[model samples]
Target: MTHSEMITVLSQRLRWPEEKVSELLSVATEVIGDQLSEPGTLSLPGLGNFTSRKSKEFISLHPETGERYLIPPSIDLFFRVAPALKKQFEEREEE
Candidate 1:
């Protein structure tokens, strides 16, 4: 779901104010972003993980020009959702 939709649902379920829900959503996303930008592991219990991979620099040819250039190593983050969340979706789908 989109961020605003999540905020609306959270506000109703938790009986929190809309403004507070918005703040909470913002903080959660900000924290996740900050953590992923670094080279480290983010392990959430019951959830899976967010890890950064260092891709080595390499030279690649440009498809059109056939020219090669040094490509910088980049950090990539991957997420694996919890099995419980997958099961929840499965059960919902069965309905």
Candidate 2:
């Protein structure tokens, strides 16, 4: 879902005003971004993690032109679903 949708849902479910929820969400996002920008890992129990790692610069192929261009090394966001979330998906498969 979009960020705004999340904020709306959270506001309703938590009984908080939309503005308050939005502010909290903004702060949470900014703090997470700042932490990630600093080159580290953020682990949230049963909620996966956000981490930064080094990668080599390489050429990337253009989908339309088939031409390659340089892709500089950069911080990438990697998300691995927590085991609990994985279990939820596996159960859905059974259904």
Candidate 3:
């Protein structure tokens, strides 16, 4: 969902002012980003872990021209869903 929608949901759920929720959301996002800049994993028990690592540079084939091009490497962010959360989605899909 978009940031505004998230703020609205949090405000309603927490009974907090929209402005306060917005500020908290902004701070939380900035903190998460700052933490990820270093090499480490940030874990939220019921959600998942967030981590980053350098990706290997690779060559890509241009479909239109059949020409090969080099794709530069960059930091890759990863999130592995918690087992419980994955199971919930899987069970729902079975219905």
Candidate 4:
């Protein structure tokens, strides 16, 4: 779900005001972003991991023209689902 949708759900489930939920969400996201910017991994228990990786410069091909080009190095973010979380989802799917 989208951020607004998530906030709405949390507001209803926790009986919290939307404004409060929004503020908490904002703070949480900001903290996560800060940690990732530090080039570190942020792990959430029973959830997943958030990490960043720096990719080396590489050559690329234009799909339309098949022309070759150089792609600059960049940092990329990734997420890996926790095993417990994955198991819970798999169990739900089986049901």
lDDT of each: 0.86, 0.85, 0.88, 0.90
Lowest lDDT 10-mer window, candidate 3?
Answer: 86-95
Model 1: lDDT of residue 58:
96
Residue pairs in candidate 2 whose N, alpha carbon or C atoms collide under 3 angstroms: none
- Which candidate tops lDDT? 4
State residue 16's C-alpha deviation in candidate 1, in Å: 1.3
Cα error, residue 54 of model 4, in Å, equals 2.3
Off by over 4 Å in 1: 86-95
Where model 4 places Cα greater than 4 Å from the true spot, the runs are 56-73, 93-95
**Model 3 C-alpha lDDT versus the unseen true structure:** 0.88
- Over 4-34, each residue of candidate 1 has an lDDT whose tens digit, in order, gives 8888899999999989989877898899888
Q: Across residues 25-93, which tens digit of lDDT does each residue of candidate 4 receive?
A: 899899888778766688999999998887889999899999999999887899999999988988885
Off by over 4 Å in 2: 56-73, 93-95
Q: Is candidate 1 or candidate 4 better by TM-score?
A: 1
Ordered by lDDT, highest first, the candidates read 4, 3, 1, 2
**Candidate 3 wrong stretches, greater than 4 Å:** 55-74, 93-95
lDDT of 3 by residue, 7-58 (tens): 8999999999999999988898999998887767889888999988878899
For candidate 3, report its TM-score. Answer: 0.72
Worst 10 residues of 1 by lDDT: 86-95
Q: What's the C-alpha lDDT at position 36 in model 4?
A: 86
